[model samples]
Target chain A: MTKPAYEGKQPSFFTTNAEFIVRSIRHSLRNVETMIMAIVLPVMLMLLFTYVFGGAIDTSGNYVNYVVPGIILLCAGFGSSSTAVDVASDMKNGIIDRFRTLPIHSWCLMTGHVTASLLRNLLATGIVILAALLVGFTPHADVWEWLAALGIISLFILAITWLYAAIGLVAGSPAAASGYGFALLFLPYLSSAFVATDTMPSWLQGVAEHQPITPVIETIRSLLLGGAADEHAWFAIGWCLLILIGAVIWCTWLYNRRAGRR
Target chain B: MGLAIEVKGLYKRYGSHEVLKGMDLSVAEGGVFALLGPNGAGKTTFIHILAGLLRADRGIVRVAGYDVTMEKLRVKMSISLTGQFAAVDDMLTGTENLRMLGRLNGLSAAQAAARATELISQFDLEAAGGKRVGTYSGGMRRRLDLASSLIVPRPIVFLDEPTTGLDTRSRRSLWDSIQALASQGITVILTTQYLEEADQLADRIAVIHEGRIVASGTPAELKARIGEEVIELLNEEGEVSHTLTTDGTITSIQDQLLMLAQQAPPNARVRLRSPSMDDVFLALTESADSNSNKEAKRA
Candidate 1:
């Protein structure tokens, strides 16, 4: 009997999935000049916040320490929209339709895209971190705690990146993806990132306190600062999980529907 | 073994408009079947339904003896489709695209690489294989697209207007590739508006018009149906001469032509013939349109 093509060549789950991810990362990283500009944006923001506006914010401890993690998160959030733009551009350019005819798993395309975005976000995050450290801001968390914080934040970023990707898939064009991203950026600011939710009006404060970003930021802050654990961590994880599941299901349905039409 | 592809009473609708109304077709294994139709004739819909990309409203569709709906994966594995535009990633090189597809089709890494190289050489794309697809000319991109489809040697292939935008040389190259595949016993179902494409490549041709199969036969059979000679007479009086010349008077003309041929033994002989495929196409569409118009008026 003739052996099948996959015989003796079965890839491990990680390797199979990682191959696409690596391809996407390589494609994204090829444009190093643009990424350098993206890296600079966060570093410049960190400097402006630390030097110019640090005195105005009434944080008792170092302002850089208080804002560095938030800036890193912001950088991740801001830069993630490019992933959506890339997806939308691909859709517009007939690449998605080409991918549909291939034998790859449907989710592989999105996985590759999200992985690339995460890699770029990590690079941008590193630049911000270096800039913060250069200005004497040190992470208070232990190594494990910092790792844990990083893990949670990465998960959150991945979840939201998928959501943005779905938006991009549905958006009319790449410009629309950027427009949607601009709308999403306001959510983090409304949360507990730049200001306390208590400072807002009661109605706005209620929304900010209960929204998904608030718990996520709170959880990360607690982990990084060695503060008391809050119930918001569970809520944040639940929200991320829900969003991840819902986005995947909805996007897959749309993709299948569109594929069927073609 | 009943048929390579079988469709029975396939129907599809979009919104309030019905695109396919009970279309049916079957193709024997290892045959080059050409589907000829004008635009909006629902040929693409039929192909999509058979490919398992579209679900028919009501029908039975099977590819390579597997039900398209229940055995979608099997059906998919048995066939490959190439549409009008080349479906390839512009960022990736030609070799990379083929290798990626090979891996997706379950080839080992080494196997994928070897298969990619083989396809590159086969398609005469070796010189351009290392360059990104974005830099490839139209013909090179089309060849790469065709190469990508052959990544996993499928038994049946669906090509929808594959040579629409190609230059003559590129079109001829594709025709050669298609013939090579078919000669290897791969069943091919192709749709083309270019009549010559159908005439040259298709062993059998089916012309579809207004969601219906207007005519089907071997190219010789279809051309034979058109008879041997077409005489074009110039009418000096325009519409009046045309109306008078074709006014249900063919019986008399037929008799006269027979009598004249018998009486005159000349070096040159004139024989009357039926219309060509282009003529048949024009007549069918024109009649279908007028019939629908009359029905609308009556309604």
Candidate 2:
């Protein structure tokens, strides 16, 4: 005979995380408003930059190619910001307390949110790239270069989404989480997302060039357009790895502390 | 039967406010136990500590023979908690929620689906089972929450204020569900404010007041300790105007009624009643309050 359903045995770790992932994905699908905003906002910004400002900024007509990489990152940032709100909402609800009483690792809660955000943001990134193509954005890249560009984008999304998930765990309320996440959306703008860093004033160039978002944007741009991709790739990978590790550590410590681990 | 839960000198505090002050309690296996307390009496805190959701400041807590602090996973596996609020996910359907918990508890997908269907029918939620829980009524949501927790019945179940805001009919239905669990030999620990709920459901009741148990006994034992009969003066509004305790003798009852008759108002009528659980609860908690106050003054 088959064993009873409530045999009181610990499930495998993969099954635990997979259940949470399914839950998070269902929530993302039901939340249509956030999903639409994540996709539409970046497409609108890409259109505005390509049509209105592309001519004045670049008389050579290569501005759309230059700006698509930054628009992709912006789409990622917008998509990942909702993860903070989702995490904070989970924390505030009694459902989290129920999960804590179960025999699974509570860190699975944040991992589920991070993984869902990564997939959602990737879809939004794909849509934004499609919109850029329609708006005269061109790139001279082989299939290998395309794979490299996609890899960097996925890594950046994973890192930022994890960071936002940690911020959600620390936030006392969903509104506060959204407000904090909104502050992070400004980092890409201050970096080399829209305009080149060299075009800014000398002092402002230092601020724009040194931030993590700048190297990532620069590396994606170089890979897509067949520019020199040696140095910027290392810096971009290093920053994403650093953020991902730090965020994972922070989430583990915070979840344990709040749940009152011995 | 073995002791399902054993707690001794359990103390918990938030900043300067002590929520659970040196409280101790125990329950035997395969019975219904009620923790009766008013709001803010630290009943939820005590339940959280026992479920391994919160750490006690200083205590020896063992659930199902495993120390809560030292063996958290074992204690967690041994117990299922339905918290004060309905913790069902709003986005998921009732069936989906139950299946998710089943999966989390290590059930196979087919087994989880079967269990979800069984619980949904057992809870009489067939009409609302397919809809998202956000659209469910408060009582329906609570039933779903309880069902989710029972996807895999552990040895012990802790329901913290399970039916606090439910209507009378809904409360009755939930009581039936709880009774079924107890009949299955699952040690069920529940907390409530209603004296009738405790008297109707619990095999034993513990009255907690100001972070300590002021009284503990069976329903009949608690009622018997107060007296045999009580003579009460009821006003026009059916409220008790005055009360007097009496032994089970005709003379003692007459004497008390005679004394009350002189002081009774024109709109007041006499009521002869048996000693009730309400009287025991009031007498126990009130005397506990005065005793603590006296201790405070002496110190």
Candidate 3:
């Protein structure tokens, strides 16, 4: 009799993760509606803010510069929100059970979703920035500054995508996941994305100035405008790191619980 | 052959509802073993526990000689599970799904592709191999799901109701696949609610009812346990009006017919039939339920 094929061989960690990553990327590409929304919605919002609200909010005509960072973050948020739906559907569907029975680590499923979302958002972010440039948004940053700005954007994307992945793990269904993720997209609107925090009432300023998005936006704006907001940079890094760690822990716990335990 | 799976004193509960209660079972290394039960009788739960997809509340479950809870990875390495529902990725093509699972099973990219092609043809999915699974019919999806589990053949396979929703032709095709797997010396543990399925395919059958294995034996043994034959008295409409058990001997059947002649109407016809798995299931489970009730009342 022939021996079973899997005996005496363990799949390499890299190969296993690569397979899942490719699977997720393929799914993301094939889901045309999600791909379109991730790019178009943010671009549309950028256009709306730059054209309609630009003159009323700021007479200096630099509203596009101030708003681009916020729109970039919103783009990442929109792209990452689909991770929640993807993860929720994977869980609710029977596919997760099949992965659980495999010899590889099951948490690799989340890694696939997160990595794919990060890549997709970065592409969408790039497209949104190009759209901003076309609509009179100018930046005075050097090569180093551009790289630094991109690093922050990527980090922010990674953090928020993982957070959405964790949400997907716990959501009862894909629709519920979308609803929960929608609530998080409003964070940028409530922060210092559109106008100066000083223009708001004192009661609302505390929320506008102190939230994570404000620090992140401030850091990005400073980078692109050729200034170093050192304190905001530290706060931005701190916030992204904190969210990344917490969401990773939460996702792992939720996955293990759902897959059953020893 | 040695036992491929050994389980004892398995107990599982979801809140106050117990799904598996003191279930004990074992399977030899190379044969088809069926866990026969009705819906909600915990057959799927038992299969899940054995596959290490669900942890037993308290039990000693050893698969391929490794303890399930202590060495889950090893247990996973030994078995592939085809769940009650088709679990293929609907977004990926059938070939892509198989190739991805192959890659996860440690096959190189080239090898995975080659194996995917082999399986696609083997499962008669050559024409639909490039199509997304969402477009496939239910039977086609089920075939791909089964093929996915076989990408890297494990020593044992757990099939939880593999034919539950399949048509007659698809069901027959799957039965052939199960037989082929067992013939290759891989132990197969399948659960089903269909008596004919268990009777037709299994080398041995274990009847599960209300979270316990009520009886386990070869198909013939189970049928003989009820009686060798059943004598049915049919009415004018050809419906069974009365039935009596016989030992399949001339005198035993003669006695039954004589007794029936005294009371049965003139239009009633006598028919002798051999016992089937259906009779064993109804007789065994009904008695088990009543006995448990009696024990409860006594307590």
Highest DockQ: which candidate?
Answer: 3
Q: Which tens-of-lDDT digit does each residue in B68-118 have in candidate 2?
A: 999998898888999888989999999999998988887888988999999
Model 3, C-alpha of A191: deviation from truth (Å)? 0.1
TM-score winner between candidates 1 and 2: 2
Ranking by DockQ: 3, 2, 1
lDDT of 3 at A54: 92
Give candidate 1 misplaced runs (Cα > 4 Å): A1-16, A31-38, A58-61, A89-104, B234-276, B291-299
Candidate 1 achieves a global lDDT of: 0.76
Q: Rank the candidates by lDDT, best first.
A: 3, 2, 1
Ranked by TM-score, the better of candidates 1 and 3 is: 3
Every model's DockQ: 0.32, 0.57, 0.60
Q: For this target, which candidate reaches the highest TM-score against the unseen true structure?
A: 3
- iRMSD for each candidate structure, in the order shown: 4.6, 3.3, 2.5
How well does each candidate superpose onto the true structure, as a TM-score? Answer: 0.87, 0.96, 0.97
Off-target runs (Cα >4 Å) in candidate 2 are A1-6, A260-262, B236-239, B247-255, B265-268
Candidate 2 local Cα displacement, residue B156, angstroms: 0.8
Candidate 2: Cα lDDT at A50: 85
lDDT of 1 by residue, B1-299 (tens): 55898878878899888888777787888868999988999888788778766788988888999998897667767888887768787778899888877776668789889888988999999899999888999999889988887877788888989898889999999999999889888899999988888988999988887676767888777665544344333234321111111212567566555555565444334434444566545655676689778989999
Instruction: Chain A only: give the TM-score of model 1.
Output: 0.86
